[model samples]
Target: MTEQRLAGKVAIVTGASRGIGRAIAERFGAEGARVVVNYIQGGEGAAAAGTAIEAAGGEALAVQADVSQSAEVRRLVRAALDRFGRVDILVNNAGVMVAKGVLETTEGDWDRTIDVNLKGAYLCSKEVAPVMIRQGAGRIINVSSNSGLYHPSAMRFTEYVVSKAGLNGLTKAMALAFGPQITVNAICPGWIRTDMVEEIDPETQQRILDETALRRWGTPGDIAAAALFLASADADFITGELLIVAGGRGMH
Candidate 1:
């Protein structure tokens, strides 16, 4: 059997009901981490995530919380502590995308995007930082996006891009604040083949593939693998870095 890299660790993965977040939670579970699967909606999906984790030979607990709200974030962390006694890793994967151009974005669209994408990460991290600091070790992985960086598609989702950009900044700041004990990082994915992305028109999809250096859509597992690396001891010396899991998008 392959080594269980995260044996005995407890990890909390926010927005883990589906897509990239679910993939990361399951991957961590397979690697031997007790997972706290968090989701704001879709109870069935979150329950499935927990079941998958247990089936993969790790324990799992499902929690529902809106990470954008400080009280709920606190409740989420408290549940983890009450159940697992300690939290060794936090994957801030909860985020919302607003598909509007800068000029077309409404105030509500901007607020919701920032609240969920940027502020959600902040609230979760804030709740976990102290717990990690007291333990003298922990890992925080933020699920950001290439749009947050220099991707051409960034301009298409104005609020989403801005929120993610803010998240990138928070990742760096948290890395510094968390210090030598806790390693903070971000994974910036591009065009992952989620259900949403798969719904894009074929012509546009092909254009995206053609522009990617790998000529393929990145899978959720691709991002999950990166998250696993960041959460495990393999990244003990790594911090404040944004690992891009795109199919080499924007490289052209």
Candidate 2:
């Protein structure tokens, strides 16, 4: 039998009830990592993910928490430690996008996007870093967006782009702070077939596909594979890097 790369490891995947987050949780579980599936409100999906993991002969825990809140973030980290003993991987995958332009975006919309997408990553990283440092080794993967980079027509998602950009910066800062103990990195995924992008109009979607070298939207599995690679021993020397998983058109 082939050995599992993440055997005996524990992973915390925030916003893991659906889409990219769910994919990451399932993949981690299949690789023999004890997974904590976190969701803010999607309890049913979160529970289902845990059930699926167990059915596949893996251990999983479903955790409900608002990653944007420090208290809730702490509780999530505590839950993981209490259940699995220690956290070896932390995937900050919870994120939201506003469909409004800069002038059209309300104050609440802007704040909520920044709070959940940017601050949430910060809170989760902060909550788990000390524990990881004590363990002497850990991996932190932030699921950022291609919009955070030079996109030709990404002005509509001002708040989301700004949040992702900030997340990239945080990834670098945390990597520097953690040093040889923990590795912090970000994944900048372009137009993926996720719930978040289901709202895109047909014309825009087709335009994206036409521009993409692969002529298709990236899948959650693609992002999950990247996470698995970064979490593995092979990535021990990699840190504070932005790994783009776009299908050629990194930004459109």
TM-score, prediction 2: 0.98
| Segments in model 2 whose C-alpha atoms lie over 4 Å from true places | none
Residue by residue across 141-228, what tens digits does model 1's lDDT show? 9999987896785568888888888889999999998898899999999988875465566877788888889988898899999998
Measured by TM-score, the strongest candidate is: 2
RMSD values for the candidates in order, in angstroms, are 1.3, 1.1
Clashes of each: 0, 0
lDDT of 2 by residue, 89-163 (tens): 999999999887889999999999999999999999999999999999999999998888767766578999999
Give the Å shift of residue 121 in candidate 2. Answer: 0.4
Q: Which ten residues in a row have the lowest lDDT in candidate 1?
A: 195-204
How many clashing residue pairs are found in candidate 1?
0
* Residue 214 in candidate 1, Cα distance off native in Å: 0.7
What is the C-alpha local distance difference test score of each model? 0.90, 0.93
Cα miss at 14, model 2 (Å)? 0.2
